[model samples]
Target chain A: MRDGRAISIERVSKKFCRSLRRSMIYGLGDVTRNAFGIRSRSEVLRPEEFWAVDDVSLEIERGETVGLIGPNGSGKTTLLRMLNGIFWPDRGEIQVRGRVGALIAVGAGFHPLLTGRENIYINAAILGMSRSDVDRNFDAIVEFADIGDFLDTPVKHYSSGMYVRLGFAVAAYSEPDIMLVDEVLAVGDRGFQVKCFKRMGELREAGTTFVVVSHNMHTVAGFVDWVALLHDGKLERFDNVFDGVQSYSRLFLGDGDETIEKLTSGGQGVEFRDVTVSSQKLKPGGSFSLSMSCESREALEDVEVDIAIYDTRDPDLYHQATNSAFGQRVDLPAGKSSLEVEIGPFQLHGSFAKVAVAIWTRGRKESIFWWRIPLELLEAPHAAGKNLVPTSFRVKAAE
Target chain B: MPPSDESRQSAEVVVYRPDNSLRRGYFSLWGDIVRELVRNRWLTVQLVKRDVGAFYKQSLLGIVWVVLIPLITVGTFVLLRSSGVVAVGTMSAPYPIFAVLGVAVWQLFAQGLVAGASSLAMGGDMLTRINFSKKSLVIAAMGRTIVSFAVLVVLVAACFVFYGFRGYDYTPTLGLALAPLSLIPLLLLTLGLAFYLALLNSIVRDIATMLSVLVTFLMLLTPVLYERPVVSNDAGGIASALSAITEYNPLYYLVSAPRELVLSGQVADVGGYLIASGFSLGVFLVAIFGFHLTETRIAERV
Candidate 1:
């Protein structure tokens, strides 16, 4: 409704000093120069200092939700800090239209010795809320946090979940013009997380601007209008959520890790040349089969073939088997060989999830070959039923 | 109540630009820092309360330590002077009362400096995540010492009454009337040093360790328990050199001037008092300017 954009970042950059002694010495030199009325350029880096965030620029229209997605230490956090004015940019300028409610880290400014109630007030004030503003929203914050009687108890006694919940509640309930959230929702329980998103949804509808930094691609795709992918302190892509996520997935795998290649000189005499999936894009419960080609350099008996599917979203969601479940016996011939494996429908929630296929020799438990395939899951026609392990892997040897 | 349409208009129009010149805003930096601190006044108060509250939260003696630190310090000197182990040659007032007032006044600045210098590092997680002015933390940490100084005020009052009963002439005069005002200069000096020390300590932590040693050594050098050493023809060696240089120690004027005013109802060395106060004011302005420039880089260092 105002005459301008909600946030504008222009060529913003922040430098970090790696060594304590060097940082101190530099600070002293700078301050001493300041004393004698000398001005120096901060854009260039000196020794032991590097740019954490380098020459980044962005702008957000009022009421838009943007997601910042990147790997650890890629400067997403540093960029957010710059946006919030926590870390003043070394070289660039930032213009914010309204107060920033930033949950940079859960309970970042919370004094452990202070009561949960006291912290809410202090944290609110730190976030640019006035005392009376906090007083007005105090009840709602307490209700949303659900701390109950623990409000009077010191936050040091609070469980991590409770601490995060209370912290999130204060920031969300403040209803600032722009809210910068930094992966705080991951700490809460599932129910609280759901509630937080629902609250965020309502806020989005209210024309509140949001810049959410998250590693969860599904959540980002669901919640944000645009996505900005950061790689190694540079913006790789700033586009619609889908394209941005695709770029991020590609970057994730592009770290000198070749996926489509022969692997594992199997001691059991069988080696897998390559594994391929029919399609990288699929709906939940969509039918897709894996095909593999391999060969045995040495003659061997009972060289049972083994295959596995590893989830990229969570490593724990893995499935491995030596025997085919579809009744066809897995046999790798002593010479060049190939197999087309078919199985049940895949109910994977993939969009950004990757499936790494691994082939192995049974009994010897020797890995034959493996490659990770980044999967893109489209929205299901109907909400796929409550299947935690959505994709099931079953293999039958080629005819 | 939720933010009304009226409150929604509080959106500030900001300009994001690259800083090509550090000199561009240096003139307005002072005004900007002051305005920002004023806006965060409530947060400053909250932080001060939290620091003072947490200090004694688990301790058995609790707030008693506020008075106890100065008391124990003054008591040790009093014992030393009375037992002849350390001869403090003086004739101003009763030794216990004279030393306690000086130590109490000195403690206000010393404690504030230590607390304020370490405040940034103490706010470890906060220094990185929150978007408030670091000036508030320095001011608030310095503010926490006021509560302990208030406790010391009560002790000083009791000392005055006890010494007055013994005919030591602890009389209230015009100088005594302005004695509390002397704390203003002392406070300015403490906070000025604190502002620079805190910023420096964030970059190099050796400032904190060095500050502790310096505060103890400086306290011994000042004429707190002992009278101002007379630098005459006969006075030579360590005594004359220390006494002559002690005149330059701002703490000497800040501590000794007000103590002289409160106990003896006299403004001893008024020119020195004015010089020290003016120097402190200069330090405060310089430190504040330096702090403004360095604060932008503080998060990185901290």
Candidate 2:
């Protein structure tokens, strides 16, 4: 409750060497220099070294949950380690209040030879639980873990799921004021994950501050109060969950300035020059339009256009459309011409979608021009199950 | 598992800063060291329990190895003496009893030092991912060694009882009970040196391989298996040099004082024993303080 700040990191950075042998040698030099009270050259980088976590600053208020989402090796884990005090930052400072529980790695320090019942005490102790605290909650931990018959068996024999379940159970039951979770929830099965999320929600309601690192954007958007997006070890955006996830998806699809290259040859007399979307951002069941310009060398009798929407994260086409299927024909004059397709109020709930547009002759096998465009969408609130369909529900004693 | 109100209010707050040794005053560092040790004492006990249990879990002999390792070393020396391969100078007691007692006392330091030195290297997994008082790892490893040493002491006791019943004119004085107290300096010296070595070993992989060879070489120079060599002051060349080295060697007094206490109910060189104990105490205090200052960096190195 001091200053109402649970965690504060100021201009922190950590450097790591690339070569293993050289890293150890540098460690020796640093240890020797520090032992004699000589300050290390933290300001400068040595050869083969780079900042794993660059200069970054953040402040987290008490009872606030923030999701740290970024691409691989973007310094999310490094930042988490620094917050947990596992690795000391070479520059700047970090201050944390209250008791902390870290799930940096599930089943960290578990002894393979020890039984599940025995390792619970050891793992919990390492996570900062006192003996009496563990003793008081031992039954709850066992029940939460749900590895009923294998409690007496050695942990080495437990399946990977059971192992993760036990590890997460001990840490969750430790009841820390500040919890740091790093990609641990991805290991559990669906049913167990639901239970884990329920437990996390309970903890969140109890005023536990959380810093979760995950790549699942939907989970991040739904669970966190705010989101911090990182790129190349730097904080790119810190905003509400919706905006943060949008930028993350945009980043995943590369910069939006990519020139639309044609996937098929545009024959003479009919060629597409440009394409644009009405709105890049859309809500669930929202209307949007796609417009394209065509440069004609001469008059065209009949033209057919196709629009296909592809999910950025999946391989198959999400939805496709053609003007010919709807028994529509278009006639184009010579010189410059334009065409626009209004597709609307559709059911789409994802971070980003790729739209592919192609123009074809009525009887031709291949389209003359094909272009792909990327669109960002705000996910539907409280989305569940495989499809994102907007619906309303009402009940009054079934009258 | 919801925490009680009192525990929540009393929760600890930790702050991390760069170059902590230079940032914090020396007095504050000392206070931090004390607090860290006291707070993590239970973790040390749990680590020790895990280590000792896991060590013997797969072995067929289990606890017998603790008794067997030192006896095997003593048996090799006893065989050497009987075969006339090497001469062990005259001793006041029977040779097997004499050698076994020397080996037991020596193993307390040698075994503890080896185990303690590898503590950090052996915990590379926990060190990289978890943040706790790392000194607990070294202390816990030494605790496992102490468990083994206790078994050796029982083996030594059984040897004395067997020899006495065999009518070899062996008589144990009450000083045997006080022998363990005299070995306290040896434990201190081993732990102090182990702290420095463990830190170095964590940074440099070669230190561990070098340590085993160095320990064997050091044992030859100390008076563990044979009687303390008597050399006159004017003896020239290697003899005089060896004499000077032995005189300054703290291990000599630390190892011999306890062995003499077990044999004659008295220490032959009380002054040397006191000085060795004082020197060991100084090394332990200074080394542990240095370890506390550098422990936070261990994670990065590992």
Candidate 3:
């Protein structure tokens, strides 16, 4: 009940039964008990039931935009639905200030046989817009949706992109105090997504609190002021965007050292050990140094080393530095040999990246040893696209 | 308590908690329903417009089905009556006009109950996604029944004109104007049962299928198509027992009151009609209270 708090969720939990028959039976029992004014045992778990959202508490202030990001079945949607009041929590309480416009499913109640102009009113009404509110914003909504020629056509005839555009436009124009947006933004084209983010930015400036659930980190990372990371129906971290994204990336990729043994199988007597980095973290325009020791059973001449860096979000090889590529040569004596590779002042997209080190013979055909190192990326600039490159923008008068 | 800002701020803040049934005060829950229904009145209208428009738009027969259904039923009953296969027993107005009028009023309840019972289940997709007042869907389902009944009223008017042209003593009175008022009790009762059925049907769909059959059987028990018989031993054991059941059936009073007013300009039992209306109002109030209590959990079960 604090001033300026838009939404306060206190230790909320919601459970779902797996078996359909048992779920229905339990629903009947609970409803019957509810009818009699008896409190149902909401705190206890029944058979075939599991908590979909467990002991998650969050306080969202006015005008703050918080992102709910987690993998599939990670309770992000459940938490969003609870905020929207579609599913009341089985335990604890949720207090919401002002009106909530939930874009849980865009075009949710639109009759497919109805035309776009007709459904605009229906969808807006469902989103909690009064009649006059829709009337005032009707033209703006249509202009924002930008499905001009197809506005008179039945929504069933419109493309999926057009349908989503109209739906998002109505909900965005509803002028709610709190907006709950799900992954429905993924349906629209790139231009429409940009328009939506711009509209959301405008709403944020007007002090509309937002709780958005999206798996697209590139989208969520740019827009959200803070991120709540969830894992397996539990809230893992609620922190700034970088910390939460790094934790989410770690969860997604699993422990890095375990994959080293499986990734380096065909080693020829030279084992790469103690692969250490100068710092585990680096900014986009900063460089990091990696050094490793190679133990060889026999002396080898003209050996080569290669270090490949990959963005952890998308594990495609981003950049590689090789001794041969740099016109350098390496010679490894019998026992212990040390090597250093300075890997970048290069730019990357996500908050975490991984580097793989490999040693090759003179022919560059056979590998001597390989190792993987996980790196923490910092201050990666958010942009419209996934690429975060060092660039500058200038504005000048057109002469 | 602060006076001016308290009401406005309290109105703006919404608190959602578990076990709502225990927290709700009796009078406040009633107030909440009225406020919510008033607030979402436009949503109810839109749902009705969407459903009714989509229904007719998709059907090739369109509005003709409204008149055709009662016509076909009346036609079969008239044929049976003419062949001496059935006994209607001393009707005041023409049998065709009488039967069609009964069907029109009876359908308002039957179709409304069926529609309302399935409203939540049919809109399960939207129900789970959005958080609008659930009563809007049930009330909007009743809107379709109103439209269908309005269309059937035209058919009933045609029955009166057709029978009147043949000199069958089918002259109507000013009571026809007040005829729709008699259906208030029937509507309230049907809506009350529909609220209960909708909640149950969302959990176990068998309630809906079972209700359709039960409605058909109840139609036979109520005197919708025939006159109410006195409990006499000479009518046969089953007939007497059915007449006995009809005497206690609330639907008989609800259906016959409006039909008698429309046909003869007076109700045979004014006391029975008043009692039935009062009973329906009580059921409606209690059922709505129960519905409002647990509607928050419906999205999950659905």
On TM-score, the candidate that comes out on top is 1
Q: Please, what are the lDDT tens digits per residue for candidate 2 over residues A1-399?
A: 366678888888888999998898888888877777788887689999999889888888878999998888989988998888888888888988888888677788889999999899999888889999899999989998999999999999999989999999999898888899888878788999999999999998888899999888768877898888887878855666777876676575564333444586366666776666688777777767877688878777677778788766667788887887779887777889888888767676645677777777766554777767676655665453224776679987965
Model 2: CA > 4 A from native: A236-239, A255-399, B4-12
Residue B112 shift from truth in candidate 1, angstroms: 0.8
lDDT over C-alpha atoms for residue A47 of model 3: 91
**Each candidate's DockQ score against the native complex?**
0.55, 0.52, 0.40
Candidates in order, interface RMSD in Å: 2.6, 1.9, 5.0
Relative to the true structure, candidate 3 reaches a TM of: 0.84
**lDDT for every model?**
0.76, 0.81, 0.82
* Candidate 2 chain B, poorest ten consecutive residues by summed lDDT: B1-10
Off by over 4 Å in 3: A236-239, A255-399, B1-11, B233-237
Of 1 and 3, the candidate ranking higher by TM-score: 1
- TM-score per candidate, chains pooled: 0.85, 0.84, 0.84
User: Candidate 3: lDDT of A385?
Assistant: 34
Instruction: Arrange candidates by lDDT, descending.
Output: 3, 2, 1
Q: Tell me what fraction of the real C-alpha contacts between chains A and B each candidate also makes.
A: 0.57, 0.71, 0.70
Residues A1-399 of candidate 3: C-alpha lDDT, one tens digit per residue? 887788998899999999999999998988888877788889899999999999988888877999888889988888888888888898989999888888778888999998999999988877778899889988989999999999889999998888889988888898878889888777688898889888888887777788888878777778888988888888855567867776676575454332333266236777777776688667666788867777889888897788788876676778887787889888888898787778777576445677777778878778766667677665553332345677789999999
Candidate 2's residue-wise lDDT over B262-302, tens digit each? 88888888999999999999999888887877777788887
